[model samples]
Target: MEPGATLLNSTLQQTDASVSLLWTLTLVPLSGETPRKGPATMPLFGKSHKNPADIVRTLKENMAILVKQDKKTDKASEEVSKCLVAMKEILYGTGDKEPHTETVAQLAQELYNSGLLISLVENLQVIDFEGKKDVCQIFNNILRRQIGTRSPTVEYFSSHQEVLFVLQKGYETPGSALNCGIMLRECIRHEPLAKVVLHSEHFQDFFNYVEMETFDIASDAFATFKDLLTRHKVLVAEYLEQNYDAIFDQYEKLLHSENYVTKRQSLKLLGELLLDRHNFTVMTRYISKPENLKLMMNLLRDKSPNIQFEAFHVFKVFVANPNKTQPIIDILLKNQTKLIDFLSNFQKDRSDDEQFNDEKTYLVKQIRDLKKPAS
Candidate 1:
């Protein structure tokens, strides 16, 4: 045999010995000895071959076993979590040398082929928060590899769209909400899956999620909610054009919500959506509505400066429109004095914001320049 083959054989044997020692450590608690205080680090590659292919195969087999466990028990769930953590280490390995990309792609394909992706979504409803986060990280890694590949990802998800809905429904459970919202956002990076989510009747449920009493869960859900609305520009624009009235009605209610955070964040995201060039049609239609302007006008007087600031961005869009619709112009004409008074004092703390100051001056001048309607 060649000298290189001999060295590889020696390395494999040593790796096998390390894995054997690790396995012995695992069985020690079962043998009634005191358990280790913390988890022992497990190398990603092991067995007689000790190579990337071996690591991928081992991770797949171990994950298959883990997914079959009754995830309700703490012991079982913890073990499953450990298994996922190890798989994550293999796929997202750390060292001076980056983990082999081809090896990780193979492992990702193995997870999908082994049907563990489906199992992860199913088990998410029962797993602990850390476990759920690990599961989401795995999906994030897998999709990052598969982003532009002309592969079966879309087909796989399209066939199992319920998995997407399951992640969405996860928001209903506070324990799972944050992680599952994270997973949902990662999944939404695919336009096909995003479309499914956007058109689903339950899409309305996010309004409730952003307003939930649990602060962390509500904030996390809002993060996903923003991704859903903003990630796919064309899809969002089309959805807005089709569902404008119903959807904006819910958003209008959000703008008026008593919760300050809810109102503030909704205004911020609204500005982002309207400012995106792809939503030009949506922005124009939204600004032309006098009621929409009225809602923003109330936001301008909000007690919170942050709300007033965000509302100003959206408010400027209406003011900057050269061809204002009759109803929109009518409202502006009626509220000219109130808007002038408010803009004069708005975001005063942002005096250093030259552009904001400039915009404020422009809005004041524009509102002042509006001609009074003929009697």
Candidate 2:
């Protein structure tokens, strides 16, 4: 049987036996085209039918059951999607003009809190960046309305640290990150609890995990992180000042680590950290050392294209500064022949059609033209 029908049947079984009988009798004629009598006057000996409290309780009970069953089934996601579509229709005042009023808002919260909606988002495997964006839009719409006397949606978001982590870890979808960030941003904007959570060790761990695992940080992850940093730039600046040596030590360890992929990710993050104006002086001092320059130069021939690309960009940045430019230039001049060969091979193997290829070719040409005569 279909899930909705099964749920309705279960609800009927749990309802008052007399109410069930009345519903059945009323619907019997519709099945067989035979006339049947509806419920007549009820006995006054039992509970009264006009109790508003009982009616509201029954509706809430049925809605809870529907929600629970919806969560247990894999089809729960499909139903939630359907509900979202229905909610959107209601929002636009286009479909089923039945006034859900506050009921729809309650239903949306119930679904979100029950983990059904999050599961749907997590299980999405297709690369529909735009669709995930639309889902975020719907979530934002539902979140905007005051559902009752409770605090706004941002309050719920601020308190639900675990939920945020699940969304970040499970979705791993780039498009969803912006919404997740926006949700976090609102928490910081409106709720004081957000400050504590954002600075928590757990939150930092989550950020590190996302940075390590996510492939295209430039799209969603980068934007979100940038927003976060921009919002809390002063705090970040202070943190870096206090932890500069430790962070550099960690980076040095990562550079010598066995896990090439993780090492590359660490290097990429380091490059980003270096790009920060607050960290510029410290990063330049570290990179200007001959030992560090040679180490980075060695990475120019690293096996991974990502690592090599990042190293190249970092080198370019380092060379942009007058203090560090001479050392970088001297290193490049020393390895001109090897660098030329590597660039030529890199150009020929560039099958990914990334826009960076032309930029890299241009840089290689500039390097060749700048090569000095042999001593």
lDDT of 1 at 317: 95
37-130: candidate 1 lDDT, tens digit per residue: 3345444332322443454455445445555654535556555665666567657764333666776767667676777777677667566667
**Model 1 local distance difference test score:** 0.78
lDDT winner: 1
Using alpha carbons, what is the TM-score of model 2? 0.45
RMSD (Å) per prediction? 9.7, 10.9
* lDDT, candidate 2, 91-198, per-residue tens: 443322453566555555565556444443444333144435545665555556564655555566566556556555533445455556555444444334444544
> lDDT at 208 for candidate 2?
54
User: Which candidate gets the maximum TM-score versus the true structure?
Assistant: 1
